[model samples]
Target: FAAAQLQADKNDVDTRLSQVAETTAAMMDDLKVRPALAEVIKQLIAAGNVVAYLPQDRAPRVYRIDQFVLKRDNYGQFTDIIIQEKVWPSTLPEAVRTALGVKLDPNTDEKQIDVYTVVEQRDGKVTHWQEIEGKEVPGSKSDPIPTDQAGWLAPRWTVVPGSDYGRSHVTEYLGDLLSMDDNYKAITQFAAIASRVVTVVNPNSSLDVAELAAAESGDYIYGEPDTIQTLGLNKSQDFAVIKDVTATIEARVKEAFLVANYRDAERVTAEEIRSQSEELENGLGGTFSVLASELQQPIAARYLYVAAQRKLIPAIPEGIRPKIVTGLAALGRAAEVNRLRTFAADAIQILTPQVFASLVNAPAFLSRLGNEHGVSSLETLLKTEDQMAQEQQQAMAQQAMQAATPAIAEAAIGAATQDPNQGT
Candidate 1:
């Protein structure tokens, strides 16, 4: 019984150890992966590769081609990273090609692709046209080749073509250009969505303050609040979603459009696709700029709020601290006029009498205070008191003239009485 129990205990220990080991390995893998996922994704996008099957007579023909860099990061990540897709209009049956306005090529079964890679120096451009042949063109004389010389290398900006590779007989099927059209649709859709999130900024004081105040009051000012840009916080999932969807679409586009014949398909261009993708990015940037402007509206509001609050709670009464009242009232009025009501509130809330004392002693505010109320100005106040005494003396002289007028009137009446007696 003791031996049996020992064996069971040993088995339990081993199980626990195994579990720990598994957990540790899983954790380490997760730790390494979580941080590197973005880097991996970027690398994959930079290294463009597309593989897709094209439609043929009553079946699907396998075609691989690379056209252009499916723009990912620049265009909110939803813009399809397009590789040029090549389809021989001749590959379809006579009836099908006639209906589709092209003939499907039977011999040219494999597709061609152009891969763009940047040169380390001079920002030079090269194109690695990967066709069915998988051979580097310019006869391996491609300059600034990646040290780990993959099948081929290309400069990022160069417009190039692919090489010929063996054609394969595959199932021919009919489908809409859905696979090709989907990436473009996805990119435009993402751009539209991003535009909605970043509204145009109409700078109006009342509206700006009201909306911000309402938002702060826990009112849902904007539906789909996720669209609103939040600074100092994680980006909205809309952005992330756009990014993710774009990457997926771009990857698929790269697959769908990649061709195996590089040199021959040079006439097929991706300039239109590339330009549209860039426009999408520019649109996103415009939207982001508008959102940024909207976000900053609060700053002005904050300043006004603090200023008003400071004025509301004056350091001294107008009579006792006339200078203080003058200065603070000016600030308060400015805050009110500027709609910086929140800033005024914050300033008042943050400042106390002790804090105010320290702030007043600061060189800038102090200089303004002294310049506002010069020592000579205070002396003028004292001199005005002396003028008050002189004004009093002038008032006494006017009273004496009034008294003499009354006595003169009485003496004239007496003289009139005496003159009447003499006349009788």
Candidate 2:
């Protein structure tokens, strides 16, 4: 009973968290945050650093590295950031435009309004708002929110221990990309030159420049035989060398990016699959840690905050905190499941079924097992006390009929064979 109650409480918490996640996701969709997040990731891989933040509305917005500058505190945390945005007057609400006193001119390109928003730690608390044309804007003004509730999430590929910013695979392999670009340019120029025909002529030779210019394929060049040869640059060897080098660099980049050739086979073994999975998880362990901390944690906290504010979910107890399950934490859960299953197997192996049933608390054991396996409504599957009692009664009645069957059949036969004649 205690075990069942504990599991019930856990399920309730899980249910609330699930509701919060679903609500937050809906808001993200309504705010068009998914596309912005995609762009943030694209920019993160293309460049090195990117930023995403939720501004209480139309969030989370993404900022490329160039669009924002950030500062870190002594604890290597982002304490301040200023993001620049170019907003057209039309995109802004009419009230905001009127408030900003924005004017439009027919001659200029719907001249963009430069908006700068700074979120920074002030007096040990963070505050944020936007500045338009040197004037502060209404809404999103200075109110201190919890750091996690402040709605900032910055995911980097990898970073130095104390650096506020991070570097990426693209940045690491930049040299190869540059070389590929330069080699491609060279090849294009060479191909262009090779495709053209430039005729050489001696000053002493009388050549019709106009005729040559107008000549088609196989047309005669009326000049001294030695002075009319076409110039050509045979760059096949150099082209081959450049291509070989480029191929080498391309292969290296592909391998680093895990786009290398596959380990093809008719069938893959479980061990091999497990090995590959472990390799990927290990290689990306550091990156996943950063995301779990920066991206997942903040999002989870923000979702809870939003849920509470909008009354989408009931007020959560102060004692309960949402945990982002990833990396080692996720593994711990998997390990727990395995250990539970193994324990059950071992108990059954070491003891007979009757012995096991006699010694163990079957209801509690089954409930815990079902909970770990994520199977809900376990009580429905388990037999009720009344049901068990009824089944036991039916089983005993059936056994009694079976045990008396032979004696009853023998008695009937004896009476049938002798009783009629003797009584007459």
TM match of model 1 to true structure? 0.16
Q: Evaluate residue 311 in candidate 2 and report its C-alpha lDDT on the 0 to 100 scale.
A: 79
- Locate the minimum summed-lDDT window of 10 residues in model 1: 165-174
Best by TM-score: 2
Tell me the tens digit of each residue's lDDT in model 2 across 177-287. 899889889889889989998887776778876777898999876676776778889779979999899878887776566563446889878667556556656766776
TM-score each candidate.
0.16, 0.65
Native-to-model Cα distance after best TM-score fit, residue 134 in candidate 2, in Å: 0.9
lDDT of 1: 0.36
Local distance difference test scores for all models = 0.36, 0.74
In model 2, state the lDDT of residue 134. 82
